[model samples]
Target: MINYISDHLKNNPLLVLDGAMATELEKHDIDTDSELWSAIALINNPEAIKEVHESYFKAGAKVATTNTYQANVEKFQQFGLNEAEAKKLIIKAVQLAQAAKAEFKADDLLVAGSIGPYGAYLADGSEYRGDYDLTITEFMDFHRQRMQLLNQANVDLFAFETQPNFEETKALAKLLKTEFPQKTAWMSFSIKDSQTLCDGTPLNEAVKYFNDDQQIAAIGVNCTKLENIEDTIVNIKKVTNKPIVVYPNNGDIYDPKTKTWQANPKTSSFKELVPKWIDAGASLIGGCCRTTPADIKEIAEFT
Candidate 1:
């Protein structure tokens, strides 16, 4: 199944991943500001989640990332769920995305189980800063159970996204290689700049770390500045031969104090940047924060 998606990427010039799941859910009156973000909607309003996936498909997205970005056991326990129940919700996230894929009935559409950063669970915007303090073993333990359940739930692939540091990325990659070697995953970093990850690791260094990892099918940037994405991809291409995946934010600066995104007047239009990202060798393209289906629709037409 992993090869199925990879083969498509290998044969097609571009594969369109879905835009922001949380932002699209907001249009359905779903609250995405809590610690769980869109994962909260998975419990309170799963239908809305499914609707957002279907909408993305209609907008020409070939991949639907699950709403499990924050649906791990620790966060659910905070919301009064036991370990068993938490695992169910985590698996449910995959089920919801799978249901949407079935309803859409597109053979090419794939479901990517979302694995967000540990800082996302902190709800402090630290995912963009990489201030967490966990050893590789601890990081593996944190992600192991969720990865197991999502793999069992039968997602087409894993999207280990928005990672801020090399440590956690290496941890997760090792976990996948050791425990679920048959599964394919993509690792996307949150960049502080075109040349560095959010934790200040040089982008080329990070890419080199995963360049020969068999479990990682692709490597690139996500939830980064629009202007920085092209340069980031160019830098990554210099280090790895893996297919590149890029899904940048909508050119808004995030304020951790208020947990809001301040719009940037100079934000580039999605239509304008899509071609540049493609020109930079991104095999997969999509949006991150504040992006909508309309943005994806434009990409579908452009590509």
Candidate 2:
């Protein structure tokens, strides 16, 4: 299988991923406060999703991540989409992103299909806690249908991101190897700190688990605090030689109960930290929650 990220990485040392999708969607006044999250826009307002992709491209992003992060077959069916309808919606996400890239005329740009953890479907923030338990087969069962859809939809690669469970991460990598041999993905975990995954798995241990997987093009963390990213990169490099992918949140504290964000005074400016992250060996850099295209522009400029 051709590693799509390498095509972009060949010319540049780092692949600049786009900023948040749900974050950008919220700015469009789209109500993302639902179980479906950004997938709701795929059902009601797909054009807005496309425009967000274009905005990131305009902001100097080299990749557009499809708005399928929180989308899944069961959730879509629960929200009134038939299985076929849900599948179509997933395919539509890839189309919308591909359309944006084509319109941007950078043919060099790429589209990564977003695959969030099962915890995202639970909608209780377990993705950041990794407390949920599922056997590897169960994890594969829940994720296989969607991965099959994204594979057939022709995504350049899958973005298995914000993964918290080490077992679940194993499931994704195994599924990619046995089922989708033609595809490759980047696996990113949610962390409790620089050295540990949200589930308390040591970052180095989880990272070393798949250090030999050729299908996993990159490995690192996402949706983590800015304060942890620099150290997180150092930790990941200690385990593997794969490309390191890091995209941290804006560092604002989120009160999930109230669905609000409070400023974190100690958080340094995103621009101020870009060089440090790059120097720490982050080959794939971008923004996560609360980050904007402007932040992505900072990374693009610095790289």
Candidate 3:
């Protein structure tokens, strides 16, 4: 399956990934205010999640990421779900995405199971700063179970996304190689600037760390500002020959306190910036926070 996606990426100029799932679900009037974010919709509004995926598919997305970004056991337990129940929800997240792909009838479409940062479980904006004190072993322990469940659920690959620190990124790469050597995944970081991750680690240094790892099929950035993306991609390309994957936010600031995005009036035109990303050597291009199917449709037409 990994090879199939790789071949497709090689043949196509760009592989279009789906835009934001939680943001799209919000458009359907489904409540996503719980700590689980989009994963909460899995239990209450599974069909809505599937519809969002279908919408992206119709908009020409070849990849649909599962709504498992916050579906880990820790977050589930906060909602009073036991370990068994949590596992069920996690598996169901993948199942919902798979059903969407089948209904959309896009034979080439792929599912990338989402593995969000440990700080996402905290829900305190720590994901953007990487200020947590969790050990590498603790990070591995937190991620391993979820990765196992997502892998068993038959996803094409994992999207170990929004990593903010160099330690967590390295730990995830190690876990992927040591535990699930046959499975392929993309490791995308959250950046504070064009040159550094959220934790202030140089992006080039972080990219060099995972450049040779076979299990990490691609390395790039996500959930970052539009202005920072091109330099981030160029920095990653400088160190690694691996494919670069970029999905940036819509140039809006996320307010964790208000749980809303304050739109930037000067947001770059998706139509204008997507070609710059591709020209900068981005193999995968899509949206993150506040991006919609209409934005994706424009990207599809442009590509």
Q: What would the per-residue lDDT of candidate 1 be over residues 129-159, giving only the tens digit for each residue?
A: 9988899999999899889999999988899
Instruction: For candidate 3, write residues 1-303 as lDDT tens digits.
Output: 255457777778788888998898988898888788888887788889889988999998888999988889878888888889989988988888899899867678999989999989988788899988778898899899999999999889899899997898878888988888778898999889988889989889998988788778888999988888888888888889888999988888888677788878988878989888888889888899888998888788755
C-alpha-based local distance difference test score of model 1 = 0.87
Ranking by TM-score: 2, 1, 3
Q: Rank the candidates by lDDT, best first.
A: 2, 1, 3
- Candidate lDDT scores, in order, read 0.87, 0.91, 0.86
Better of 2 and 3 by TM-score: 2
RMSD (Cα, Å) for all candidates, in order, is 1.3, 1.1, 1.4
Candidate 3: RMSD to truth:
1.4
How accurate locally is residue 17 in candidate 1, as Cα lDDT from 0 to 100?
89
Count of backbone clashes, every candidate in sequence: 0, 0, 0
Q: What TM-score does each of the candidates earn?
A: 0.96, 0.97, 0.96
Q: Lowest-lDDT window of 10 residues in candidate 3?
A: 1-10
